[model samples]
Target: MSTELTSREVCQHLRDAALGVRPLQVIGTGTGQVSVDIEGWRLQLEFDGKHLHHCGHCCCPDGREWALDSRQRFGTDPVSLLSTWELAQIEGLLRRAE
Candidate 1:
C-alpha cells in the first residue's frame, strides 16, 4: 500500500534527521527547493507544487564525486507521492551519514 505524505511531514523528517542540533535549513523558498547539510553532504528535495521533483544530488566524501539522488514521486498533491516507509528510508540515509 502506498501512503502519501504532506510537505510538512517530509520537511519534519528531514529536520529530525539533520546532522546538527539545529533544524534543516531552507535554501530556496521561492524556488520550491529545500536542502539540508550534513557533514558536507547536502540533501535536497524539490517539488513543483504537484510532483516531487527528484532531481537532487549529493557530494561524495571524496569531494570530487557527485551522485544523483533518487526519490519516488508518483501522485497528485503537493509533494505527496512518497510513502511512509519510503520517507523513513530516506531519513535513515541521513542518519547513517551523520
Candidate 2:
C-alpha cells in the first residue's frame, strides 16, 4: 500500500526542491490575503479584489527593488508552473485530505 502524503510533507518537499535551485518563488492565495513564498522567503499582500497593498515584506535582497518588479509580472497562481514531481506530491496531499 502507498503511504499518503500530507500538505506539510508536500510543502517540505517543495521547500527542499527550492533549495536546490538558485532562486525560488511561490505565489498563492490565502483566506482573504495573497502571499508569496519564495523558497523560504515570504512576502504578504492584502487585496480588496481590486487593489493590492503590500505588507512591507519583500524577499528580494537589498538594493534589488527591480527584482520585485520582475516578480510582479508573474501574477498570482499557486502551483501554476510546478514540476511533475511537485504536482504529484501536491495531488497526493489533496487526496489524503479528502
Candidate 3:
C-alpha cells in the first residue's frame, strides 16, 4: 500500500531540510510560495496544482541585468554581484527551502 503526503508534511520536511539557512523573502502574486534575492540571483518557488516548480536566474553585469524584465528596474540583480560559488550556495539554500 502507498500513502500520500499532506501539505503540512511537505512543509515540515522542507523546514527541516532548511534549518540554519536564511529564509527566502518572497514577493509576488497571491501564492503561498517563497523566493529569494541575494547578490544577483533570483530564485522563485511556484506552486502549480499539487506540485512545486523551482526557477532561478542569475544576472551578469553590464546592461543585461537591466534589460531582462521590468522588475530589474526596481533593484539590482544579485547574480551580477556574486561569484559562481556564492551563487551556487544561494541556489542550494533555496532548493533546500523547497
Candidate 4:
C-alpha cells in the first residue's frame, strides 16, 4: 500500500491542521519557502520572513490560495470545492497557518 497523500488528502490534511485537529509542523524556514509537514507529505508554504500567505482557494472571494503552491496553483480545491460558508470556514482556518 501507499502512504503518500493524494492531492485531495493533502488538502483535507491542511484543513485539519488549520483547525487544530492535526499537527502542522514547521520543519524548515528560508523566508521565501517555509517548509511544513503533516503526517508525511511536505510542502514549502510561502513566508515573508514572518507570516504565511495564500490560506485558501483562489476563486473564492476571500480565498488566498495564491500564497502557496504545492506544485502548482489551485493544487487543493479547499475553497473551490466548498459552499459559501464552507469556503469562509476554510479561509478562517488557514489564516494563521503555523
Cα lDDT of model 1 by residue, 1-98, tens digit: 32433344444444444333444443443366556554444546654444445524443244532334245344422124456654555445434433
Name model 1 segments beyond 4 Å from true.
Answer: 1-23, 27-30, 48-55, 69-98
- Of 1 and 2, which scores higher on lDDT? 1
Candidate 4 accuracy as lDDT: 0.48
What candidate 2 gets wrong by more than 4 Å, as runs, is 1-26, 37-42, 61-98
- Which is the better candidate, 2 or 4, if ranked by TM-score? 4
- What is candidate 3's lDDT per residue for 42-96, written digit by digit as tens? 3444444343343323222221321224444322332334444544554476445
Q: Distance from true position, residue 16, model 4, in Å?
A: 0.7
- Model 1: lDDT of residue 92: 54
Candidate 1 global Cα RMSD: 11.2
Identify the leading candidate in terms of lDDT: 4
Query: Residues 1-98, candidate 2, lDDT per residue (tens digit)?
Result: 42432223333434454444433333666654555554444545444344333233334333222122334433223233455565454334333322
Q: Kindly indicate the candidate among 2 and 3 with the higher lDDT.
A: 2
Which has the greatest TM-score? 4
Query: What 10-residue stretch in candidate 1 is worst by lDDT?
Result: 72-81
Residue-level lDDT tens digits of model 4 in 1-98: 54333446545656666566777666766646566665654555545644344333222122222323467566353334444454454445434554
TM-score head-to-head 1 vs 4, winner: 4
TM values, all candidates = 0.35, 0.26, 0.30, 0.47
What is the full ranking by lDDT, best candidate first? 4, 1, 2, 3
lDDT scores of the candidates, listed in order: 0.43, 0.40, 0.38, 0.48
